[model samples]
Every structure is written in C-alpha cells, then in structure tokens.
Target: MRLEEIVIDNLRKLRRLISVRRMDDAEEAACKIVKYIFEDAPVLGLDLDGTIDEAPEFFRLLSRIWPGRVVIITCRLDEDKARADADKFGVFYDELVTVRKLEDKAEAIEQTGVTVYVDDQDECLMDIPMDVTVLKIRNEGNFTDGKWLYSGRTGKQIC
Candidate 1:
C-alpha cells in the first residue's frame, strides 16, 4: 500500500480510538504512526551563520563524525555563497535549505525531515514542530528562558 493510504488508515483508527476515549491506545498508535512516517536516519539541522560559520572548526569535526547526516538550514539570501563558504570551511552537509525568510524556516525544516534542529534564534525554534528536537546553541544573543529541548556550547569563535 502507498504511504498515503497507510496514513489515512492510521488517522481513521486514531479518530475511532479518540472518540471512544481510549487515550492510551490513541497515544500508542500516534507514537507508532510518527515512527513509521519519519525516516530511520537521524538528520541534524544546523544554522549557517552562528552555528556553522562561526565555528568552522567545530563543524569540521562534526562533519567528520556525522558525514552525510548534517543538513544546513539558513536564512542567507545567497545560497551559492553559503554553500561555497561551507565547502571552504570543510563543513560537510547532505542538504542546504536556504530559508530566505524567518517565517519559512519551520516549513523548510519540516520538509527536510531533520530529527534535531540546532539554531541560535529562539523565536525560530517555536515555529518548528514538537517532534523535531530543538537545540539552542549558546551564543552572545541566546535566550535564557529554557524553552528549547537542549542548550550547549557548540563551535569555536575564530578570531
């Protein structure tokens, strides 16, 4: 059966369980549906400016470790230049999604199927889906509200 057919069937089952107040069953089914929908490989989403370019050395190491799992999501207007910079710094990535606008970041991330998204902007994190883990990489302008899933120092400032 096609993926759409499976999804529709799951939705119908989920609705029936919800209607009967079978909270536990509905939750379990929801989890199973989520697992089946997402791809197996964990994709790491990285911001271009503060996360990657700011610490090229760190990303260089990350690229070595993760290889093709990294996906760069950026709001940079010039995609070619952004890609060129990543290549120059040896920051490996399987995909580069140029967000172009702040509002489009979440949509871009959702489409890419990243498991974890790392960015410096706190507001952008709010737009991303709950299923995707948001890692708030520490920076000069980071939010201290503790809203995101994880916070840590990533990358090194090359001065």
Candidate 2:
C-alpha cells in the first residue's frame, strides 16, 4: 500500500554498520524511497541522524514526483541542521521536529500523522508505533535475487 507519508530514520541507512561500499550508492539507493510518497498533498518525514548524506538523490526523485511538501524529524534535537538539510533535500518540512531519544520516534511520527516510516535500525523501528508502515532496512544479501538471507533476532542474516 502507498503510505500517506514516508519516514527515513537514518541517513546512512545501513551502509554505516553493514557491508562497506561507496557512499554514493547508498545515497542513491535511499533516493528510491521518494517514489513511494510521490506528489499529491501528503507529506514525507525523514528522521535525520546527523549524517552527512542526509539528503540524497532519492529525495529529489520524491520532489520531482511531488512538489514542495515534506516534513523532517531530527533525533539530535538540532534545529539548525535540520532546516539546512531540509533545504538541501528539496523536500522541506512543513515543520521541523527534534527529540532527545530515538524512542520518541513513534510519538513524534504519530503526532505528524505519518503512515510509513523507513528506518535502518530495528531498535528504532520497534520504538515507533505499529499503525505506521515500518520499512526496516535489510543488508544487501537479503535483497539478493537467488539466495536470500534471513536476519534472525540477532540482527545477523543467515544465508
């Protein structure tokens, strides 16, 4: 189902802890997320984790599909960076929010009326409310065409 809004919880996505690849690829891959929330009037909230690649091409893709409409939630409680990043992403938040803990993700998302949230960490995902769409990130191996890896409770995907 197409979510009313898309929420990205991490800037690195998964490349930060998982397999070491070029930063550009991960950023571009993140860009694809914009397609899910294309155009209309719905909003997009990307939870910036204070990473350099917070705004990527995937965001631009969303903007192209949907003009001037997006929201951003920052975990660091850093308003300045969030605003600047919002400008960089081209998907400006109708309003910017900041919090001290990741656990606040669900509460924060709920307040904004978000339906889908994309996050790399399972912990952060758990923190959010269940009503929202939780698009948790998986390692590249999980997305492999042939052999798929199931990341059990330990966060280690067994091939």
Candidate 3:
C-alpha cells in the first residue's frame, strides 16, 4: 500500500532566524492544513526545532482532527537540553525524540512510519529515502494569503 502520512520538519531552522518577525500566512496555511487533517485524505506531521513557542492551539486543533496519529520530530543535539526545552514549551507529543546528526532524518522518519516530510530546508532532507517526499516551506509566491505577507510590510499600506 502507498503511504499517506505527514511528517513536518524545519521549525527550528525557521525559528532561529532573528530577522524574521512574524508569519502572516502561518495561520492561513495552518487553517488549510487543519481542514485537510480532518478529512484524513493525508495524515499530518509536525516538526519543531525548539525555536518557536509551543503552539498549544495548533496541537489542540490537530489532536481534534487526527487524534493519536500526529508525530512531532525534533533535534536538540543534547538530550538534557531537549528535555529542558520541552518542559519550557510544554510540548506534549507522541514522540519527542532528539537526534544527534542531520543525516539521521530518514531513519527517524522511518521509525515514525510517516510518508511525507515537510521541511523548510530542502538541502537537509534531499538525501532521505525515496518513499519519503520532502516538501520545503517556501518564503512566498502563489500561496495566496501566506505568512510572508507581513515579512517586509510597514504600518501604512502604500496605495
């Protein structure tokens, strides 16, 4: 049988960039994703790098839709650091495993049995197993109302 599970990645990388202020499209994209999860058309995955705040709302929403199927992947470089950050963010997850190397992405996803890996960095996920499709989160373009809208906007809308 073909796989249809979701595996998210690249949150840590996206979050660490100090220059970025907010993602306007995040909520919109998330809303669409939430709808998709409820349909069960394709399973969803959530990956975090411990940079963004623990999104209780997103977790709660996904939980209501997918229940026990959502998987969260992350890397902390240090187990103690991971636990400390998990506690700090209150990230209650089915699997909150820490990874040592970047190349372990495939093995980790294999363990979760997820089909697609949604990451922001294409380079890191490029070498994963063929069965695992890697989707890079784009900065903008054709996404409609995306988080990138507010990237460089000012208080006054230029007419």
Candidate 4:
C-alpha cells in the first residue's frame, strides 16, 4: 500500500478502537481513505453474473463499445469456471480478478485502478473506496429499488 493509504488505514483502526460514539471520526477516516484512492484513467470494474450474463443487452453493448477499459471482478471461487463462462458468453475485458468474499470486491476494484464499477450487488458496492463511481446495474435477482441503478443507457455515459 502507499503511504497515504497506510495513514488512512491507521486512522480507521484508531477510529474503531476509540468507540462507536465517535462515528463521525470513523466516517471522516473512511472519506479520507476514499479521497486517496482515486486513479487517473477511467478504468471500469464489472461484475459477472447479473451485471453481465443476466443483462445480455448491456453486456453485448459494452463488449463492443468499451472492451479495453473493462476489468471483470467476481467473487467466484473457481477462476477457471468463471473464465470459461466468460469466454462462452463472449464477455470482453482487459483483465479478470476473482475474490473469495463478496465484500472483498472493493479491494479488487481498487486493485483494478478503476474509477467506475458496474455491479448488481448493493452489498458489494457499499464499502468500496469513496472516489470510485459505482454504477449499479439492474438485475432481477439483486434489484430492491433504483437507489444506485444507472440512469443512462451506455457504458461510456456510465464511465
């Protein structure tokens, strides 16, 4: 991790150690951490099941349109299976990162150096670093409301 990230992380740990009474401090620490994580290029972090295969039209359009900017991030244990499925479905991406935990996706997104992330899971998007723009795509399985859902049609607009 970078120096700023380490300092921000220490602040968060300190906030936690202090008490739940200092919620504002925790929030501030989180915001500082987020502020430090934003990258230069408009890289994109994309989810697998619902964000891609479940929404065929969006995936088809994205693969043709922004093939180079995409980095597929999934909480799939079997990397091989996920890659095979992506290949079978013709999903386009510059790279793929698989994680064991759903929440850990934030770390993968951070690692991808993406400024934007498109996903179906609200849980996954919740604690992602602040600077990243989250485009929560609509999927039948994960949709509760339109809180984080993207208003625009294309991936370019999303980025």
Candidate 5:
C-alpha cells in the first residue's frame, strides 16, 4: 500500500484506541505507528556535527530504535574525530560519510538512497529531492525556513 494510506490506517487505529479510553493501548499503538514509518524507510540519514553532537543521547536512542540502516553524513573535515565522537556518544550507524561541502549532503543522500534525512543545517537540508522525507533538527543557532516532515527533537509530525 501507499505510504499515505498506511499512515492514515494507523491514525485511524490510534483514534479508535483513544476513543475507547485505552490510554496504554493508544500509547503502544502510537509507538508502533512511528516504528512502522521508520522501518518502512530503506535508509535513514543523519547529520553528525550540530545535529547529533547537540543531542547525542536522543540520536543514540533513535539509532538503536531505527530498524533500517543509519548513515551519518557530515561535512566535517576530520573523519577520525567524527568516528571517535560517534563512538564516545554511543550513536550507532551502518556507515559514516564525510562530504567536502554542505551542499554535497543532498547528493550523498541521493546516492545512498536515504528515504528520511535529519539535519540542522539549512544548507544541507535544501536541494534534496521531494521523494525524500526531510526532517529538521530543532536548532536555534541555524535558521531554516523549509517545511519539515517531522521534528527531529520530539519526533512530532509536521507538514
């Protein structure tokens, strides 16, 4: 089925659970919906520096929960330092890629076939194809005007 249809069905199920006042079941169903959405993604892309570095624990949890391959795509020059930091932060990833420029991030995502990408930099988030689900990590330092599919911080769905 289409992604939209699947999401709608899941929402309906969640609504039914909530209507019945089964708070626990509703919460479980909500978690399942999120898991299903991420699991359906073939690959998940994450930005290392500002995004993951700002919130290592959150990203670590996400990396562990995601059922698909996680790729850390960053524009940092020092690959060794990035690797060490990732290890120290306990963030899991299938691969770590370093791009020469922030604009190169879009190309990397396309090349890696990332269905969902999370980044704090607007430069990296822009130019990605519409087919990819772009999520913005809430970063007050960086100004991003682009509409995001979800909030990386709270996992809240956005337009």
Candidate 6:
C-alpha cells in the first residue's frame, strides 16, 4: 500500500477506536501513524516568525524526533536574524529559505518538495497546493475561524 493509503487507513482506525472508547487501541493506532510518517522521512516545512518563535522548544524537540529533513521557510528579509533565532532556540533544520514575498512561500514549498508544512499565517497556508498537507498553527492573531486539521491556543501539539 502507498504511504498515503496507510496513513488514511490508520487515521480511520484511530477515529473508530476513539469513538468506541477504546483508548489503548486508539493510542496504539496513533503511534503507528506517527511511526509510518517518520519512517517515510517526509520533508517537513516550518514557518519561522509565528510558528517557531511561538514555541521554539516544541519545534526543537520535533526536529530531534523527526528523521526527515526540516526546512524553515520564511518571508523575513533578514536571514541573519532568522538564523540567529534558530541558533538561539536550538531548532534543528536542514535549510532556511527566505522568500521575497509571503505569497512566494507556495513556490518555495514546491521547489523544496515539502510534503507537510506548518505555518500560522492564513495567507501563506491558502496558496499551498492540495498535494502538500498544511497544518495551521492556531493563534490569536490568525486562523481564528476555519476547519483546520488541528487547533490549539499554544504552539504545542494537543492530543
């Protein structure tokens, strides 16, 4: 089976398990999904300003855990400052791309072949193609209303 198929199947199983109140089975299924994704080594694209700066520690931990290459895509003009922030926060990333415009992020993602991307800005999220899975980081500033894959006040993953 393809990677997407396996992920979808596991997600369905997880949903069913959760609905049936089978907590243990649901947890196991969730673990399997995460393992499969990491094993596949999907290139993870992350935003710098709102997403990473909001919770640097979480991103740092995720970089350590994720086996794939992590790319930081930002519209920030100052590459030096962005690099400094990454260094200060100890966030591991394979590349740092500074786009000329926020709308150019979609092109950057395409160029880098990012399979999964996370950002807090709705504008950036809107232009990304359907092929790439986009996760909107919920914050007071943006994504206040919409059917996002996940929602949380803080940058940390809520589950």
TM-score per model over all chains: 0.61, 0.53, 0.45, 0.61, 0.64, 0.65
Q: Per-residue lDDT tens digits of candidate 2, residues 82-101?
A: 67876776653466778777
From the highest lDDT down, the ranking of the candidates is: 6, 5, 1, 4, 2, 3
Query: CA lDDT of each candidate?
Result: 0.74, 0.55, 0.49, 0.72, 0.80, 0.82
Off by over 4 Å in 5: 1-40, 143-159
- Which candidate gets the maximum lDDT versus the true structure? 6
Report, for all candidates in order, the number of backbone clashes: 0, 1, 3, 0, 0, 0
Query: Candidate 6: which stretches are off by over 4 Å?
Result: 1-40, 143-159
Give me candidate 1's TM-score against the actual structure. Answer: 0.61
Cα lDDT, model 3, residue 136: 52
lDDT of 1: 0.74
Candidate 5: tens digits of C-alpha lDDT, residues 87-139: 88888788999999988999999888888999987778768999999987776
lDDT tens digits by residue: candidate 4, 93-126: 6788999998899888887787888888777887
lDDT of 3 at 72: 55
The candidate maximizing TM-score is 6
Q: What is the lDDT of residue 144 in candidate 1?
A: 46
Which parts of model 3 have CA positions greater than 4 angstroms off? Answer: 1-44, 50-60, 83-92, 138-159
The better-scoring model by lDDT among 2 and 3 is 2
Q: Lowest lDDT 10-mer window, candidate 2?
A: 1-10
